[model samples]
Every structure is written in structure tokens, then in C-alpha cells.
Target: MTHGGGGALYLLLILILVSIPVTLIWLFHGQGNARKRRAIGFSQIAIFAIAIILFFSGVSYLQNIGFVAGFIVLIAMLITPVVFKNRV
Candidate 1:
């Protein structure tokens, strides 16, 4: 089986779209714990990078669906600290 280059582009676009909001929250969460938020954000970015790589290489069974799942997880991760406020 083979995948097309378009798949990688789509995944990268989606990744950017999903990351923008999370980045804004990360930037503007004035009361948030800097160290905690930074760590969480970094880890999620790393996961996203891996997801994109796996999708691009066509070696993982997850395919584009993995990126979708990653986006959902990123959204959830972003929301958690916002809701918790002081604890984050």
C-alpha cells in the first residue's frame, strides 16, 4: 500500500490549526503555572511531531486518524489547565 504527499500536507495544516488556539492559551494564561504549562505544551508538541512523522512515513497503522486523535487530545489538554486555573 502507498500514501500520497497530500496526506502529509493535510496533517501539517490540521496540526497548525489545532495548535494555534492552544498556543494562544499557553501564551495568555497569565495566572497559570509557567513551568507546568510549558512542560505540558512541550510534551504535546513532541507527540504531535511524532504523529506527523508517523503519518508521513506511512509506517504506522494509525494514518491520518492518528493526527485527528492527537488534535482532540491537544484540545483536551489545553482545556484542563484553563478549567483548573490556579492548580495549573
Candidate 2:
């Protein structure tokens, strides 16, 4: 892939799309407790930060795609808390 604006956008889109499902699974089905949730959340934030960097670095790096996917997954991760919070 080329390191141009279009490629960067493509990578971003792909990453966000992929992350959604993974986030949902982790949020809903992962084992552990609140601590685990906190850990996962922090880890995901770190991962996302890295991904953003990678996404911008170039268009061909594996992390570009991975990070985008992770971001998508993170949306789900973020939502779960709000969803449950309203109920509880």
C-alpha cells in the first residue's frame, strides 16, 4: 500500500470495523473481575494509541490495520459500560 491520504483512510476504516466484534466479545465474555475490566480497558487504550500512531506512520504497516480494528473493537468495549451502567 502507498503512504498517501487515501491509504491512511482505508487503513483507519478497516481497523475500526474489525475492532467492534473483538471488543464486544471481550467485554461480554471475558473472564475476571472489575480489575480485569480495568486492565483490559487500559491495555486497549494503550493499544489504540499505538494503532493511531501506526496508522499514521505509513499505509502498509500491519499495525495500521490492527490498530484500526482494535479501535472498532474498542467502541464496543466502551459501550458495554454505559449500557450496564444505565441498568444498574
Candidate 3:
């Protein structure tokens, strides 16, 4: 059971890390459409933000919760703009 839990925690960490680049691309590319892109960006941000909050709070709710998930979410938030930056 403990091993399964550890594996879950690790998988979650990897998912979070992968989400970083995906979310950033989603936000940036979504911007081209303005209304559509902005909405997509906002939703992506909200999802990541909530994920981060939940990840941290999960530490109290469940032992062995990984912090890497939250860190990756944070990185996604930071990279969103760079990926979305206007290009000529």
C-alpha cells in the first residue's frame, strides 16, 4: 500500500511537471484569438493555481504528498507569458 502511494505521488509529480509546458503553450497560443485565447489562458492558470493550492494543502490532508507538483504549477504560471508573447 505504501509503495503504491509512493508511486502515485511520483506520478503526480511527473504530471505536474509535464503540465508546465503544456499549460504555457496553451496560454500563449490561445492568445492569438484574444477572447478565446484569454479565456483559455485564464482557465489554464486557474487550473494550475488550484492544483498548487491543493498540492500544498494535501500535505496536511494526506501524508507523503509531493511538493514538486506545486512547484511545477508555479513554473507553468511563470512561463505562460513568455510562451504567449507577441511575435512579429
Q: What is the TM-score of each candidate against the true structure?
A: 0.58, 0.42, 0.48
Total clashes in model 2, counting residue pairs 3 or more apart in sequence or in different chains: 8
Tens digits of per-residue lDDT, candidate 2, 1-88, equal 3456455566556656666565556555555565556566667767776766665564566655755565565565557555544332
Tens digit of per-residue lDDT, candidate 3, span 9-87? 6755676666666655665554456666566567766766665566556355533233454555556656666665563
Error of 2 at 34 (Å): 4.1
Query: All models: lDDT?
Result: 0.64, 0.59, 0.58
Any runs in candidate 1 off by more than 4 Å, and if so which?
Answer: 1-15, 24-29, 60-65, 77-81
The predicted structure with the larger lDDT, 1 or 3, is 1
* Top-TM-score candidate index: 1
* Clash statistics: count for each candidate: 0, 8, 2
Name the candidate, 2 or 3, with the larger lDDT value.
2
Best by lDDT: 1
Q: What TM-score would you give candidate 1 relative to the actual structure?
A: 0.58
Per-residue lDDT tens digits for candidate 1, residues 14-81, read 65786657665764564667877777766666776776566556555666566566666666655655
lDDT, residue 54, model 3: 63
Superior by TM-score: candidate 2 or candidate 3: 3
Model 3 scores a C-alpha lDDT of 0.58
Which stretches of candidate 3 lie above 4 Å from their native place?
1-3, 30-32, 58-88
The weakest ten consecutive residues by lDDT in model 3 span 58-67
